[model samples]
Target: MSDLDSSTPLRSAVLHRDTHFIPKKAIGGKGSYIFLEDGTKFLDSTGGAAVSCLGHGHEGVQQAIKDQLDQISYCHSAFFGTNVTEELAQLLVDSTGGKLSKLFVVSSGSEAVEAALKLARQYFLELPAPQPDRTRFIARLPSYHGTTLGALGVGGHVMRRQPFEPLLAKNTSHVSPCYAYRGKKDGESDAEYVARLAAELDAEFQRVGPETVCAFIAEPVVGAALGCVPAVPGYFPAMKAVCKKYGALFILDEIMSGMGRCGTLHAWEQEDVVPDIQTIGKGLGGGYAPVSGILINDFIVETLDKGTGMFRHGQTYQGHPISCAAALAVQKVIKEESLLENVRNMGAYLEQQLRQHLGDHPYVGDIRGKGLFWGIEFVKDKTTKEPFDTKTRLSSLIQEKALQPEYAISLYGNPGTMDGVRGDHVILAPPYIVSKEEIDIIVDVTVKVLDEVFKGL
Candidate 1:
């Protein structure tokens, strides 16, 4: 067997990310590794954009899915409810300590975000004093919520939103994200930085008319657009205060950073704040099935209960039984094995090892993350924190090098870490079950690849 040659046209009809860059056919995967049809195995460090938290071919999750199929595979949520779906929703609510009183299960993160936006708008309309003018949303810059139009409109990722700008809704406005790495000024204390971001949010609310906003959305740890940059201490509470003062709902998009990815069942748990609405995906089902959901706090539930007595949004696959079963099984495995503790312990080791190996590298500007989710940003001049030119494709080169036969490793690379158009960073989010030995291998191989890429620079 040989790797798929790039010179040859791809034989399949699938619309790949890059038509010219044909990838090897993955024949199988098991335990944090995927096997190409060419008999090569690559350690999955980024877990397919942080989706495969339980890793590959989990026997328990497989069994759970099969068991669910035997009982019932396809039951539309609007027509009927399955035991598995109900149980999964209950588990999610219980995990949140009942602060989030209602759940709306969807098939994917994008769908969940869309539903959350709709729910937020509906909640305001349902109030006794109907806020017909509360039609706008406040989001953070350099953030990614999802791909759907509603989700994309609220997102601030420059490259992704460029082509679709005309079609996107004009109701969403962006504010500066609490990104301390580059956004914080010299000699500025963490508290000062937090205050600055809060003031910006407050200003945005006023600029858009506080009563005109339905909700404010952000990722607890800014993903993709700016890499895994967790806000400094007291950041969330400060932002939430702004949302509350404006009489707008606070929504957290945890699609990439929740469901124990950041060492807590909910990433916001560590931030010491409770969002009015929350959307979660990726790690929620550990790649076992397509599943995501929104958690609504009591305020929304109470308002809807008293007014419409129903949520206006519905989907054909609202709560797929098998998907719910798979997610439930994935969550159960995480709890029974106590993987959150492993994430915390290994996350510290990963940060230490990354800093130890790459801290002095001329191009390594910053390394930041929490739990197993981490990002290493590259700069042309570390002292000045100047990013490489977008035309250089530095992040792409590193990703390509890491996946070569010599390294046989996987990583997530993205451009526009500094803003929407000009920065580069690579993210590494290994499975929570990763061991210290595996962490060493990941770190060592990553350093080798980086060295090879920047050797002549």
Candidate 2:
């Protein structure tokens, strides 16, 4: 070990997550592309797992963060609420047509979910018709809420929840997800499918005794777990009706789909029903600052305002002023630029590019999604719609190949598509700022990588 004979180890000191192969360092980003340390540029198609809605290195967002730092950065919510946080809350509540009259900011999607669950429980305590027996929750199978204890307990992703089964809430149960692609029976019409799913939820509420079920939570457009799948028409209204009939809260987790990632300002806008409580993240701060929050409708907010007058749940970083500033600026830019229109127009273009490039691939089982989000599912038998085995690692392999410097296109969540274990699918939630040429490159790399991976398999 003398200086003259010194040698270097192959790796660095940072603890690397082993989810994929070693990730290269990204030097900087601008618009729809990011540059690596080796001077390799990638399309950044998935916007860093759908977190970067405004793309990278946005000047205005950076300015907002700096402005907050100039005045104050850290102030506990217990003492005072910052102006930045106050305005952001107003903006979010106003965006929901005043239906969501209240907002509670937190640090991440998981925290938001935890807060929402607690809020629902507290709402019951403040209810005009109090029902202390209401403790049960009904979430959908193959859905993900968050990684924290309560959120994880309510989440039904089989792969994620399997290890924690012993610790999850026994009061929580799972019904079927609105995955029409796989769940809908062959002969069932859309109306029948929606009705059948509603019936299942009704049966679940009855089994637990409707009075015992506190909430029915879901994602308006299912993300990661099911690969950008949207519910069929009339699904949300039907689900909302069931919740209302049983006096259960409807909590929509739009952590991945909200904040104009889709054509509308919210994914639920297209669903024809508003939720009692909604969780949103990822796109909230556009990856400029770590932030998320819960939106409570008039009914829930009014209940607490008159009774408890304070939320029982609290977090150390709740309503951090700096995070709120960044989010406030991000929302301003969206309105100023009219980005939702861009999402719709460009989304149509993206679908066209995907169909022209990958639509005919033999192993490609399905290509579906809306607005700026999409998913490509792989299968062993396209006709039978059977997924490739989880151990095969087909999706991850394709994702890895796409992320190579030569490929230069970063894909979004490479989720296990089958009950969270034995399926293959990759998400494409490119920034709304993506251009025509960038869209073509993303599709090209994906198609090329799939072909290469399938041949090897």
Measured by TM-score, the strongest candidate is 1
lDDT (Cα atoms) of all candidates against the true structure: 0.91, 0.86
Candidate 1 lDDT by residue in tens digits, 363-397: 99999999999999999997889999998898888
List where candidate 1 sits over 4 angstroms from the true fold: 1-6
Q: Which pairs clash (backbone N, Cα, C closer than 3 Å) in model 1?
A: none
RMSD per candidate (Å) reads 1.3, 3.3
Q: Residue 44 error for model 1, in Å?
A: 0.5
- Model 2 worst lDDT run, 10 consecutive residues: 1-10
Evaluated at residue 203, the lDDT of candidate 2 is: 95
**Which pairs of residues have clashing backbones in candidate 2?**
none
Against the true structure, candidate 1 has what lDDT? 0.91
Q: What is the TM-score of each candidate against the true structure?
A: 0.98, 0.96
Give me the runs in candidate 2 sitting further than 4 Å from their true place: 1-13, 19-22, 413-415
Candidate 2 per-residue C-alpha lDDT over 25-121 given as tens digits, one digit per residue, 9 for 90 to 100: 8889999888887788878888877889999989988988998999999989999888999999999999999988888999899999999998988
State residue 350's C-alpha deviation in candidate 2, in Å: 0.9
Candidate 1 lDDT at 266 equals: 99
